[model samples]
Target: MTTALAQRPPATAAYSPPSYGLVDRVAGLRHHSPGRLQLILTTLLTLGLLTGLVAGLTAHSASAGTADLGNRAQPLMVEAETVYSALADADTTAAQAFLAGGLEPAALTQRYDDDLARAGTALTNAARLVPDDSDAARAVAALSTGIARYSALVATARANNRQVLPLGASYLAAASQLNRETLQPKAQALFRLATDEISAGYDAARSSWWLILLLVLSVALGVALFWSQIYLSRTTHRTFNVPLVAATGLFAVLILAVGVLFANQRTHLDSAAQKGSAPVTALAQLRILVLTERADEALTLAAHGSADKEEDFERASGAIYFDDPRLAYAERFTTTLKDRHEAYLTIHGQVRKLDKSGDYDGAVALAIGEQATTTFGDLTTTLDQAIDNRKAAFTDEIGDAGDGLDLLSVLGPLLAIAACVLALLGIRARLEEYR
Candidate 1:
């Protein structure tokens, strides 16, 4: 038995008395071996490399989220603007034709048809984009119905005008109410949606800057660790620790590059929003202004043609339904509309005087030339110019926004993956030396 024990090397020191506790076990383990400086360096370098990788991943994620939201919103905003413009233009053409003496010019008729068709198509596209249950989708659907009904009313009004029946005026009044009540409010809702999304995009863009700071920290930490490892190697007279230095340098480059790329991407997105979306929004507002004026003018004319004051009162009260329920009566239409009405009242009083004097033709001619053509038409052209200016601005901005983001969308991921792979390879090279 003694010979056997000696041959078994005293049973390997009886497993070191099973350690007294966890702390004791840890103490005992440490007593057996001291960590090399190179190992400490490697540990720090590995941590920095992981931190850089995590930062890169986070930046990529944030950028992707921003890109997705902005990209989806862009085309939808375009569709909304197109639908609004088409509806407004159609109303304008119909009103112009009415002022031109019962004669619906072929061109005006065709324009109405085309615009109506375009509006329908646009609404269909919007529905597909917005989903069945969204508020935006509901607003669009309501607007579509209102447009169809208004178009029919306008047609009826034009037909009645051929017979010199005052009922045409009544139809015009109803159509004007539809424009105010259903379509405008719906349009406003869509605008709010677009604006909200745009603001969110700005938030996303701003938030991404945090990634840059993380990158900076990671790079700084990596450099510090790398230098520490070099110092240790020189002091200890070890030639090198391949994994430790390699991981530090690799992570440093990756973190720094990711930060730079993200900064560039954010700048590009900002440029896009400023150039394209902002201008378009302004133009869209101008178009709304013009359309409101046109509808108000049509209502005034129809009120004048009504048989009794009762009809006029009913139409005015009914027009209220078209305005947003949330807004007070005074705020529903433009201030210029009040001015237009004051001017109309003056002309109307003069026409009543002419009627008393048996100068009906003179009154009629004055109504068409001054009230219809000059007052409303000239003012509309001025507003149209404003609309045009805004439209041009929006077009340029949207183009820039799309181009800038799309560039980042393509380059950001590719560069990020490449950086990650390079960092991993550098780390692996050091790890391989451990074998």
Candidate 2:
């Protein structure tokens, strides 16, 4: 089959037209058409993101700060109390030994001496940790003087008793009076100050909890606003401005993460306080109660055995005033001391009976054997056990509290960085859609 070939005319030289006259108009229309809404949204989102991120970081920092106070400040305060307690115990023991009229049993006397030395050393160490020149510091200084005076009086009493002089009872009475008047009130004041410090720490921690919730709410609202913009632009067959979406998403994630971490830290701190620290405090109080009772008992025995004027005995054995440090810290001590005291009274009754029957040696033996040897020592050991147990509990909980806060401290900043990066990527992708 023969096909007829059609010749195509040569293509006319391509006609060049002059560039459009309204170039500016075309450019302006392209710039103004969809850009206003996109620009507004993107700017709003960016500002919102920035606000959220800043607030989130602030909240996280606050939470960490509160945790630190709880962990560091409160523990130091507790340690101060421990040192004070040890000092009081030492002073009480010394008074008891002085009451024995002659030099006390070598071991008992040594304990009193050692305790005094330990208390002095402990006070020095505690001073280093305490915030300088606070009420706590003043109290510690007062207590140190009281302890020193008490020790000197006890020594004088011992020297006089050794010489078989009437001065012995007077010296013993002075030592006990010093303890009741000067040292005990200062110690109690220190304890109260420490308690206030810890309570303030707890308040700071609790306050951060509300901040986390507010941060979360802010993040949620920012995210939802960004999402609404995205939906509107997509249904209209346009890309929502990339910067706005990116900024919003970045901040939303940052704030959300911060809020979550802050909440977690708060919970951890609260748990530590409730389960570990609170129980320990309760146990510590119980131990203090027992020790106070023992101290009172020793003082009672010393007063009874002393050969002195009735006024001397009354001064030596009088009630430890409400302002006394040990007495103040242990308000329930009176009841606890009384409870333990009945046993000592029975021994006292026996000692009196022996004396009435013209058995001076037997009475002395009974007083030393029953009252000094078994009951007082046993109760002191129990108190020590309780104190040690609670201290351990507080130590363990502090570790956990630290771990929880450490995690929270780092997580907020990391998430915020990630959110910013993600938002930037999202915005870049939206920008490409327009092209």
Candidate 3:
């Protein structure tokens, strides 16, 4: 204690723990038969485990995405479409009522009211699906705010019309302008977002990279199992190890089954996109265009500005006439929509002729007459049915896509573990003989 530093044992080398060189150890183990068997066991087990994990995870993800496609994405798009269509229909109906001088037709009034009600209900439903503070949410909010202002304008228009005031036409025109310019565009934007989500969802649900990875691992393990068998037969002069053989057979069967299921899911996903969402989108756009045309037709007469700036209507009609572009994407109700649309166009021509000939009252009668309403109603009903059919197709295909996925999610990993255990047992037996 008097001179601890001097008395202290001359500083020995600091205590150090042994450190292994992992690569060197691995190198030492790879040269002999028993060491090789151990390495093979480890490699095969790792591959099997990886394959199992990827397969299980991919199956679960695909199943969930497909379900969401059927449940959330498509339904939200349909709701947004309903909002757009209903708003345009309401505007068209309102314009028609305006054209009928005093005390508008009860039927027209009723239809107009129903259209607005439908729009409001659909907007609420859309709000449920859209995330808050997103573009879709903003659009929904804008639509909500605009509707009240639009309705007030319509009410003012109606009041003035009932009293034979010219200002009523201006108000009706303003309301229509607001709907066409502000509200319908927002609804369409919401719809476009929903459709874009569907497109991206299909790619995510496919999980193609995971499928390829699982496939590669499965094949590598299978080849390793084969090579191990061959090496054992050459080294031990034995034809087969029953456990290893059985394990190989099981692995093959699992791969085949999973491959079949993966193929089935991909097929269903493609069909859902093609026969369902694609058609649904094309038809929705066509229907929206038709509604716009109807609104413009009534607005044209009401405004009395005298020139046909119906470029939108012309483009829509040309697509209908050529049977190309929009209608080409969806086929079921093409004939019905086209026939009704053509009939309406012919009637619209007569309405325009009467107006140009100075038979203004007669033009108004034909424009809001039973013929026009029936034609429009027929086309609308048919389009609705077409959309419903496509939606059902989407749901059915998505349902098919999800089939067996849940079972595979659990079963795949279990089979992989079982095969790994069997292979390990066979290799360990060989190693024991050496010991």
Candidate 4:
């Protein structure tokens, strides 16, 4: 059997898949027709850049917040504490010298001078750190003016006391009033402001949820790209795409590392704020209260018949001993303070009674002589010990917080860059197969 053969038809033109030059491909991207290889490349590149940018920005913010918490906020708080203590001690020392009459010890005189100088320096330093338009700056300015007036009043009181003038007591009382009513409150406000700033830094550092979300998106994109490579391999009958695999693995590792580091930093910073900074602030306020009470006691002695000073003392002491909720955190410290303060108040009552019963000499002896050992002296001693303990605790907690953030700032951006580069290389390698 013979089979008949059919003639082939002539082809007019060889059919070709659409081809694009570099410029055409670039233009096609804008027009949304850059073909599969360009689209994949562009998507991978864009994702990598976005992921890297997010990581870098987040890392920078975290680093800045951490730095402020450790360096600026803590130091400002310390300086504020110094300012409060120095001003209070100066007032206390001046009163003691006044009570000593014209025979004021040379050591007490030197101590008063030193305290004033230290307070002045600390205030200046704090002012330099704060914004010029801020409330802290205004408070420092007010304090500067108040301290000058205070010095003049104290000097006048000293001169009058030397000449055995009763007006000396009035001048001392005025200075103490200026401090308790105006200057001390301003100082306290400044301290509170500094604590607020530290709290803000902590909040900023803790708020990394956006970064986490970005990481999640990047991870999801990485997984998708990785599976796309698997799809490509299956369709092309290839074994693997090494670059894509590496990119995915690097992204996974980077995200995991960032999450862990961020979590740890947040934990430590939160602990510091809760256990360290907050308690220190409370203790500092308590210290201010103690100093104010001490100053009031002395001023009342100077004022003699004035009920206002005594009332002020009662109110101030009541705020700390009975009213403030913050003291609940340090029950032991608060209890110790209460006991010492109650004993001091009892001695204070006896001193007042002696003065009122026509025993000026006895009142003076009880206030500044041997009887003071169980009253003002005991209260100050216990207060000092408590302050020291709180300070030590603050240091330990803040130090631990700082230690936790040591590695994050450097590692975060680096991993991000690595992930970005690997992604670009992976997509480029896949695209080269088409070429």
Worst 10 residues of 2 by lDDT: 9-18
Model 3 pairs in collision? none
TM-score head-to-head 2 vs 3, winner: 3
lDDT of all the models against the reference? 0.56, 0.57, 0.83, 0.71
What ranking emerges by lDDT with the best candidate at the front?
A: 3, 4, 2, 1
Q: Per-residue alpha-carbon lDDT of model 4 for 1-435, expressed as tens digits?
A: 123222422343222223335557566664432255566666666676666566656666776667777667766776787788788878877877787677567877897899889989999888877776988888889999999999899899888878889888789879877876787778878888888887787867655665776766677667667766766577455677677667677667766766776776677776666556766677777777767776777766655555536777777777674334654445666776678778777887887789879897678678766566456666666666765665566566555655534455566556656765776676666666656
Query: Which segments of candidate 4 are over 4 A away from where they belong?
Result: 1-34, 163-170, 209-213, 216-220, 223-227, 322-335, 356-358, 371-375, 403-407
How badly does each model clash, as a count of residue pairs? 8, 8, 0, 0
> Candidate 2 residues 1-435, lDDT tens each?
123223533344222222343554444554653453355445444545555455544555555555555555556556665655665676566655664546677877787777777667766765664677888778777777777777888888888888988788788778767765666666667766776776677666555555655555565646555665665477456566454455456555656555565566566666666654554455455445545645554554555554323233234334323233333323343344444444544665576677657676675566557454575565455445544554565555555544544444455445545544555455545555666
> Which candidate tops TM-score?
3
In order of appearance, the predictions have TM-scores of: 0.62, 0.67, 0.88, 0.81
Q: Compared with the true structure, what per-residue lDDT tens digits does model 1 show for residues 229-270?
A: 565567444666555455455554555555566566556556
User: What local lDDT does model 1 show for residue 9?
Assistant: 43
Candidate 3: where is the Cα deviation over 4 Å? Answer: 1-20, 131-133, 155-171, 306-309, 325-332
Model 2, position 314, has a per-residue lDDT of: 32
Our model 3 lands, by Cα RMSD against the true structure, at 5.0
Better of 2 and 4 by lDDT: 4
